[model samples]
Target: MKLKLNQLDILLEVAAQGSIGKAAKALNLTQPAISKTIQEMEAEIGLPILQRSSRGVTLNEYGQVLLRHARDIDRSLHQAREEIDHLLGKAMRQLRVGFTSAASYGPFTNTMIEFQARYPGVKLVAMEGRPHQILDALQNQRLDIAVLTAGTSIVQSGMYYEPLYALSNTIIAGDQHPITHTTSLKSLMNYPWLDWDEPGEHSILAQVFRRYNLPQPQNIVHCSSPWVMARMMEQADMVSMWTSVRLRFPGYNVNLRPLALREVLPATSIGVLCPNIGRLSTAGNTFLEMLRINARDWLQQSDAAEMVARV
Candidate 1:
């Protein structure tokens, strides 16, 4: 290709920072040198890639196209380095994995435990975040794999989502809550509710109330931290949505119990999202296999009603 990797690097930096001088400083190159690289690239391409302005430079259509491939090339080059190092016995295999908050309730940690016991040399880095955040990390080459629910989720190009299992969620409350005794959508809404603070997630609780033609609850508490929510559930009359497998994870107290309501949340797909199976590193592929195997067992053992209590 006419555009060298270093030139593409400069272009990407300039696009991100929006200033040639900033890009030059970041790349440890002189301002004129950065300009010369762009000039050379434009000379070869026979068109301008950036729109020069007094404030800063931005990528034009041509520049955006080049940047898309540039990022891909950069990630592929990184994978190639890791592959070469592993083959040379210079570095141990590493797997970077991420999961959404809902997926944390699944058997991800158990699978990781078994995988680590089996492959002592493979390194694992795990992260938990929202679905969009996980997908962003995967697309930015920060994470090798991500497991999340496929419900009104973002779908990016060049990324593949493999459905692993069907997942469900439900509302949970402390045993002290009055709604626990007399469970009704109206009665459940009477008390303050706690839920995830993720804006991208579908408001299943709100949707359920709306489906019943009831006014939306006014007393709602949104929490981003599951630990904080659990604490609140133990201390106060708070209700929140939780996956059936949530009981498998730690930090939950005996005070919490699932509310048997006639209305249940919609089901979603629990699956693995990654770049490409063929491009996955040795450890990455192995971890993906572990997820698949564990997901099958989890789905088979999980009772449908326990996860999603539909009337």
Candidate 2:
């Protein structure tokens, strides 16, 4: 039984996203198309390879075994293509970058600005989405890399990552909030809260809340955009937990304070992840290098200084 590589790619995507609908969106194929393709592959294999569950997509034993060989095939094919491109004297000039909104506002922007300064000739295609969307794009070959919260669930073979910066979780309330100086958890639980829980777009504050064994804040509003979040913040008495990196942008009338929980929030690093390392272009490689250097030299140092002052 011979399975097509495209079918394998689709399977990997569905497995990563845990949703056929999202995989279809990333592949520019309809749900029926993706499902049929996977079904066709399963037919050829003469066994059930994948399964769906509330927890997300998971691979059966055969699927896991096949995934390893399928990834090797992908890597070999990628290496062959890279070799041919190199022989043709081709260098990458067009790059597709994906990031979450917070990443774009933070060091992800800085990394791109620095790359542009060095490789001004490279054409950049930038796409933004919540974390899962970005991962889907990367998996579907729509993007070469994505900036997202580190230690995500988008695991696939041959994927590589670079840690860019760490972010602090703080409750961002509007200026109307009466608790400006209050860092105590008891004080913070008094107000309304906001959260963003799009697929794979987990917030650092969620972990903080869990660590303290605290209940969800009393009142709550949900937002998907920084701008919308900002607007809501201005118009209502909402206190949402957000990353310091995001709040650093423009005017978001937020009163940021460290709520004295049982322990400090375990900061999540924002990482630039190449969902496919086997296919990195030369320009992408260069951009990755510059990102690493900037993270080490500039972003981390500045963030450290800012942290010392805040603490």
Candidate 3:
């Protein structure tokens, strides 16, 4: 009932290392000492916490439940220490952000620069990952905020989503690709297709084909990394769907161009995802505010440009 912080720390270490001996070594303690701690914890909780076997150990049902709370406590304690350090001027504050590659251009990058300029003392850590990976990190408390493409199916409950901009999606290929001049999806099926992995029954490209009652492309490569996808597109004749905003970014536009297809792809929105329960730190909130401002400006500019094109 009254588990101490050290007890939770030992439990976490045991769960992480998967063996008492290994946990003891990691914690700089004897094997028997680690065993005794585990026994005491089990006695206090009135249930076995771990299952031991020849292949080390694994957390049981009760241990798995406790492990989640233990990690939360660990993160809370670390944040407390960081806040104290910041107040004492002993260390710089830090913010951890996870974002999808599609969200890495234009407004997102601009907000990052502006945030850094405004909060020079806060250290910013940014990680690039697929949308699902970024959302998982945010749920696990590994990241403070996530910037990803907003999809109703992809955003889980218990997270707050703020719509940023509805970016235009387009099929793109290397400028030299033979099919680059093709105007219809049906005509491009003979060429290899590169698809970004999305969390759904079908990818956007596949959905588009299905909507038109066309057969799905036979030669398709599912890719997760944007950099790898870009490199592959540049080196091969493969075509892929990407956001217009991302395609406009420097390295991409240099070698890749949107195919002039008559098909109008559905626009995808980029958004900010954060904990809805006010878990964000002051620094995190400031960065979120800057993102909102930049997104507003970017949306306004996009509207004006669309109007000009129509004129």
State the C-alpha lDDT per candidate.
0.75, 0.70, 0.80
Q: Compare candidates 2 and 3 on TM-score and give the better one.
A: 3
- For candidate 1, write residues 120-149 as lDDT tens digits: 877778998867677779889999888876
Give the best candidate by lDDT: 3
Worst lDDT 10-window in candidate 3: 302-311
Cα-based TM-score, every candidate: 0.62, 0.62, 0.64
TM-score of 1: 0.62
Candidate 2 global lDDT = 0.70
What's the true lDDT of residue 71 in model 2? 82
Better of 1 and 3 by lDDT: 3
- When summed lDDT is taken over every stretch of 10 residues in candidate 1, the lowest stretch is 302-311
Q: Where does model 3 exceed 4 Å of error? A: 1-92, 180-182, 198-202, 302-311
Query: For model 3, how does the per-residue alpha-carbon lDDT over 1-311 read when each residue is reduced to its tens digit?
Result: 88999999999999999988899999999999888988999999999999989999999999999999999999999999987757745323888888877787767889889988987888999998877777778878889888887666455555888877666778888878987454898888899988887425436777778878899888989988667888888999998888766666568778888888888777776789987627677777778888888876876675424311121
Overall local distance difference test of candidate 1? 0.75
- Which TM-score value belongs to model 3? 0.64
User: Candidate 1: deviation at residue 32, Å?
Assistant: 67
